[model samples]
Target: MESWLYILCICLILGAAIGFMAGLLGIGGGLIAVPALLHILPQVGVSAEKIPHVAIATSLAAIILTSLSSARAHHKRANIPWPLFKSMLPGFVLGALCSGYISEMIAAKSLQQIFAVFVILMAAQMAFPFKAQSNRDMPSAAHLFIAATVIAVIAALMGIGGGVLLVPFLTWCGLQMRFAVGFSAATGLLIALFGSIGYTLAGWDAAGLPDWTLGYIYLPALVGIVSTSMLMAPIGAKAATTLPTAKLKKIFALFLTLVGLKLVFA
Candidate 1:
């Protein structure tokens, strides 16, 4: 009981940080949550082989609330491109729903390595920001569907909201950055929702999951994380306007780089 309490405390703190950084840096909490959970789950009786699966599933579950909040904010601000979002919604749902089953077939170590590579790439993108040139027109509906499907699949696999991939893709297709961000946030909610469901279904009959689990989602950790993350996100957003965000992003990028390397070599 005491150990459980200690783990919950750590999760709360981790969630607070994830929320703040997400707001401040405009990054997904999963990047941090996945790695942290990889460490925390073992202490809660999660087997070594199942650690990555649980971590990714739990992170995706935790994202639902945060992404909803973000999407609502963007909608209120008229940031989201409703037509575009609507057009791609089906594809996003389909792809995210497929990712859970796909991941179940892959080895845990391979997933960790894939996540590590993703983290390293994200860190590099942060440290050296890339401005997408808006040179092309929006593609046809079929093309949009295909693109959205691909993005959703990758995002689900990585336990992320798909902003890193979506924003750039939108911008490259002549959408403004603000609209791209808003659209990405809106789509992230769908990814989280459907992805969580997919993961839950995929792990339902799996062996060796710890107690208090809804399939792969760890209830205690999810509760602890969502409790603080929701409250802290607004505060962090408020801070972003006043903070030296460029410098902070660089520092955070370095931190991500280290975390990625640790995962790769661990």
Candidate 2:
């Protein structure tokens, strides 16, 4: 009982940080949540073979709330571009819906390794920001669909909200930074919603899951994370408008690099 309480406390604290970062950076909180849960879930009795699955699924579940809160805050600021969001919604839904089935086929170790590589690459992208030589208009509908689908598939596999990829893609397509971030936040909600559902359905009959699980989603972690993340997201959204985030991004990039390397070698 005492240990459970301790774990819940840690989850709450982690959720607060994840929420804040999600709102501040428009990242859906999965990047942090996946790594944190990987450490936390094993302490609660999740089996080694299922650890990555639970961590990723639970992170996506948590992101459903975190991203919604962040999206609402960004919406209030009028940052989201509605037409683009609408245009990409179908593809996001389709790709995320398929991700769980795809993940179920992969070995847990392979999934972890894949996530580690993704994290390292994302860290590099964040550490050295990309700049497009010339701003261009949105691509054709088919192009948008392909891009959104691919991004959603990757994001779902990694338990991310897709902002890490989406924001950069949007900016490269001539959207302003603020708008791109906001748009990414909105799209993250869709990804998380469908992605979590897919995971839940896929793992419904799986063995060795810990108690209080909804398929692969761990209830305690999800509840604890959402509880604090929802509250902190608005605060983070407020901070984003005032903070100088370039330095912060670099610091976060370094943190991600370390986490990725640790996962790779562990």
Candidate 3:
């Protein structure tokens, strides 16, 4: 009982930090959430071997709510390009579903190794922001479909919002940064919804999941992290007024690099 309470506290603190960073950096909360959960879940009695899978699954599930709220806000501002969003929707959903099935078949250690590599790559991207020189317009339907499918699959596997990649891609293609951010927010919701469902269905009959888990998603961890992060995001946004965006992003990049190292060595 004491240990559970302790775990809950840690999760809350972790969520708060993640939320603040998301708001400040405009990065997806999953950027921090996945790594934090990778550490926190095991302390709460999740098996060491299954920790990576559980962390990723739970992170994706939590993002469903976070993304919905975010996308709604962006939509209210008319930031989302409905046509572009629609073009990508079907492919994203299909890829997420396929990735969910694939995740279940993967070995635990292998998944963690993959996640570690992804984390380092994301950190590098964050530290050194992409400046795409291309000014091409949005691609045609067939091209968009294929592109979205690839992005969604990779995102589902990495347990991240497609925003990390989508935002830069859109900007390179001549979309304004603001619109790209908004579009990324909307697309993230679709990815999370389908990916979460995939994980749930894929692990439906799996053995050895802890109590309070729905398939691979751990309920207690999700509840704690999502609730706190959602509450803290606006706080972080408000606080960012006092700091430089570039500095904050650099700090976040350093943090990710450290987390990536930890995961790789552990």
Candidate 4:
């Protein structure tokens, strides 16, 4: 036996690093975690045929915990925009729930390619950093619903918290960065929660699943990642002020690009 214990060790290391980077760079850990899990899960005996769906579901499960913590902290600050949050919930929930089923329908290779593309796009956004304002208030309820739905679907598909899309959209709608971030944190909770559940349901009766899996969500990986990410997020936040994020972001972005390419062609 190759000792599945190494999987836990790998998860802890991945979690700790992600927590530090999240704190250090303010990016969601999912972007990193999805790729990391894809690499690590096989060590624990997950089949390559199921790796993509498994990675995504497990990442979303991890996000449920992380996003909840972030949402709570942001909520304490009283910065979350409740009205917007309320309006978007219907669409967000719907999209997230559908993601698991949708993912199950797709091939693992296709999913990996999508994730790879998504990762590259996210890296580009973060690394390059662009902001444009339309000088308008939030859109109509219908528009908001539609936009939220799109974002939520993608977030579920990518196993991310949707902050990459949400934060910028909120900021563009005239919300300050701080408020936008807080709002996005709250929203991430919704995405993670429903998204993970959908995955669980989607994978409930899956074939050849590992011993500790709940649908596509890998239990050991989730435990290790959630435990460490929570502990390190604050540390990352503290270090953010002192780090040369500009340079770091560029380097990390390049790294993500390579990772994305590897996933696509691997």
lDDT of 2: 0.87
Arrange candidates, best lDDT first.
1, 4, 2, 3
Ranked by TM-score, the better of candidates 1 and 2 is: 1
> Which numbered prediction scores highest in lDDT against the true structure?
1
Ten-residue region with minimum lDDT total, candidate 4: 1-10
Location of the lowest summed lDDT over 10 successive residues in candidate 1: 1-10
Give the per-residue lDDT digits (tens) of candidate 3, residues 1-266.
Answer: 75557766777788788788888887877777787777778766778767877888888888888899899999999998887867788889999888878887788888887888888888898889887746787788888889899999889888887898888778887888878889999889889889888888887777766777787888877877888889988988888888898887888788888888887888
Which lDDT value does model 3 have at 73?
Answer: 96
Please give the CA lDDT of all the candidate structures. 0.91, 0.87, 0.83, 0.88
Instruction: Give the per-residue lDDT of model 2 (tens digit) for 99-158.
Output: 998998999888998999898898898889776534788898889999999999999989
Pairs clashing in candidate 3? Answer: none
Angstrom error at residue 249, model 4:
0.8
Q: What TM-score does model 4 achieve against the real structure?
A: 0.96
Clashing pairs in 1: none
Q: List the candidate 4 regions with Cα displacement exceeding 4 Å.
A: 1-3
| TM-score, prediction 2 | 0.89
Clashing residue pairs for model 4: 23-236, 23-237
Q: Which has the higher TM-score value, candidate number 1 or candidate number 4?
A: 1
Q: TM-score of every model?
A: 0.96, 0.89, 0.93, 0.96
